[model samples]
Target: MKQNLDLAPVGNCSVSALIDRCGRYVWACAPRVDGDPVFSALMDGDDPEHGFWEVCLADLKDVEQAYIKNTPVLRTVLTDTNGSAVEIIDFAPRHHKHHRTYRPVAFGRIIRPISGAPRICVRLRPSADWGARRAEATSGSNHIRYHCTDLTLRLTTDCPVSHILEERTFRLETPLAFFLGPDEGYDQEVGPGVAATLDRTVVYWKDWVRTLYIPLDFQDAVIRAAITLKLCAYEETGAIVAAMTTSVPEFPESGRNWDYRFCWIRDAYYTVRALNRLGAVDILENYLVYLRNLVDNSAGGHIQPVYGVGLEADLSERIVDSVEGYRGMKPVRVGNQAHEHLQHDVYGQIVLPLVQSFYDQRLIRPGSVEDFCALEAVGDRAYALHDQPDAGLWEFRTIARVHTYSSVMCWAACDRLAKAADALGLADRAEVWSQRADTIRARVEAEAYIPEEGRFGASFGGRELDASLLQLVDLGFLDPMDPRQVATFNAIERDLKKGPYLFRYVEPDDFGEPETAFNFCTFWFIEALHLNGRTAEAREIFEQMLSRRTHAGLLSEDIALGTDELWGNYPQTYSLVGIINCAVLLSRSWTDVR
Candidate 1:
């Protein structure tokens, strides 16, 4: 319960909450992932008295936590010094109900005694206006309704309301259930409905996990990562968020925090590819809808780097001065400004996922002519802007460059479009796109490669190395074994590499040098190493990275190279994608064992 950082996440796709080891609901957004945090204690400084919902044992001694096997449901066992214990089952209700996903803006918990009688107290505090105001509470016999300015939450419980309101310690006689959601009264008994939802939710998650094409090795790690990725998705609109929390610093006092609760095209592309490899087409199909929506709404113009989970275009960035950031890292940010930048790589990210629909017959909605035509407009942007400068994938605030990675992705966009066109039997369109891809590839090789240094540069002509260059092999711009790629890998390892982790880049930016290592970049380096015939080394490094995950088998966006501490947002989609991808590449095939 005393653990400060390295928090674990639990959520249904619609909403999520970060629960600390002390069995406290520290952070949760309402209605949607990007909504105002109803429980904002994670960013409310070190105060444990407000902005949180917690069930505290009067004489707590030991605490142990884990997920209900193969599920997102979390189980925490708290043992009191008096030799009494209670199990806390926490989850967001998610299962099939009435022919659709029953995920709601809700949080549920059941506390059952596992040993002798245990004394417990409940602290339920929800906030609004980014922690500027606490919810006004009103209670009846079995429920408490907390009303905020724009939102209300009803806490239906099986325990006495007096015990909760007065914070009185009571002996555990029967299992108590609490359900928090949109301030709507329950039609049935709270205990039975929550119990049944727990049963079904467990089945739902296990059944989904069974469908995964997980590798023989690291199956648990891969499955855990996969579950986090699924939780990060906004299922209603098929938009996948980059992470659950926002503005957890990338490094101590480095001022490198950003809101990651929105969907980044590049991050979604990598996330879906990982899920696709696991044979999870539902996520891919849903994300394609988000992408298609973007293309349709683009009005035949450029696509932004990021967007709201519900496809809102203008995400104006601002800071919340009310709530102190995670670990008192001030300037808690809400909205993202990356929505206005022209990150050319998005054009390719959009096309890459759409390309899969054309060939993968597993998808519910395969590629059609309308989809192709819409995507053609996206490809047109990639071609026209391939040589131009924009905010790179890193989204540097002050600088723009024709980054090698962005250019390579543009080439990938045209290249995949040509292939998709040919598959669709549009020969003329295929020819034109093929010629365009050739032109882009030629330009990238001529300008992105540093001939004097015998390797590819981060920008068109600069000599700086970037971890994103690890993507050149992935995008098919260069062979993994090509001499230039080999040299580039060597240079990256020599410069950006810190132990087993890799920094995105070391150059000074508006915020000074990025002091932390990007977790996903290290995975990219492992893949590159494996592709270049360092298969054993790749497996070793891959294992080391796996060891870096939190106790919940999840990772944040960035890690401190100096202290090996997780510093960024929780359950980062990119970090999980790295886990899935590296496991797929390095794990030995089942055929080998057979």
Candidate 2:
């Protein structure tokens, strides 16, 4: 009964919910990914009875949970000491209907008796105002409505409404279906409608997975990672969330927690890149639209590192004292303050994802010359601020420096813009961008590189080592075999590697030293090893990282070095991206399938 990130996520890209191991709806945001948490038990600490929904079986003895293969649909079975059992299946309905994707902001649950007669109690206690109070309810004959401060949710169920409303236990005689969605009347019968939705959702996910060009090995892992990444995306606005939940600390009493429900340009770029590798161009296509809108709105102005999925500008940070933090850590935050930080590398992240549309013929809407012109605006910003001191990709609040990674990403912006121009036969613009890229590269080589240590430091004229530097080769900033790049890799390993994991850095930041190994950085190390021709070693470490994933085959942001326990946000997109990228990097090619 301990709280953990060992939860399964079910969503349709429009709405998502995190269900605990025992089939409890712990966290779910309504309206959108960044909206209010209707079920806030995940962050309620010790007092969880008010902000959760669950179906409890009397005399429960055993339980089991798993996804319905290649889909986000989850199935959980509860068995009691009397040998009676009941099965619960959960999902958010999404499928192609009426020539368009029909994804509702809804969740569907179907419960059926698997053996003998099982008695169960339906406990649906939603909260409002960040768990300050329980939502008031009004019930109809076949449905019950919970009215929160901002919105009202309707639970339409075929089960005895009185049983659910009064929290009474009932004997399971027939299958029951419950649809929690917008406060609207459902058109179809609950049982048949939910069963049909389940069938369609399963088919939709399986069909989507079939299109992916999976590796010969770890196909299941890669597919699950890909689906989880897809779930993190808000399809309505084409924005991808960093993670589903917020305020989950990086370590115990670490005070390093932040809300990750919004989209970070850098994280979204990596997510898009990984999915693109698997031939899942739909994500790339959707994300490109999001980036294009972001660029257009900026109009060559400052761009924040993160933004609301709906492109809201100001995300002032605020703490919800109503709910205690995860595990009573305190200060459960809603909005993120990092939106105001000057993360200069966002310019390159903007351009990196946009540059692909110009060349990928599979896209329904390819990049136009006008799109290239808009991107040059972003490239201009990259060139103008390439050397300026700013918050690095790590989002250090109290420190600002001329991070090498930021400058290198600026170089990449200009470098890719030049290539994009060349593809369009705009030699003049190409020359302009190419020269800017060369100038930035020369400055980085001259200032960021250390002669005595023979490696690039985290910041210009600074000697601190950072794991982000491991991305030099992956970012096209340096050749994998470059002696300088190799030296930096060695120094990072020597300084930051803790057994099978890699810490982002050893130096203390605003929250003291990082207490856990960053999951994504370890994957970067694995990629570095593979690129350096240490295939056997890389594969060994990759397997170790795989072994560290949660029971749902997902990873959080950080892992405790000593206990190997997951910390930080749940189902982190960055960690999931690492899984797909490393599998693609280390897996045998399809030619070896025989």
Number of clashes in model 1?
A: 1
Model 2 residue runs over 4 Å out of place are none
lDDT of 1 by residue, 184-261 (tens): 888888899999988989999999999999998999999999999999999999999999888888887878778999
Top candidate by TM-score: 2
Per-model C-alpha RMSD: 1.1, 0.8
Write the residue-wise lDDT of candidate 2 on 171-284 in tens digits.
998999999999999898889999999999999999999999999999989999999999999999899999999999999999888999999999999999999999999999
Q: Return the TM-score for candidate 1, rounded to 2 decimals.
A: 0.98
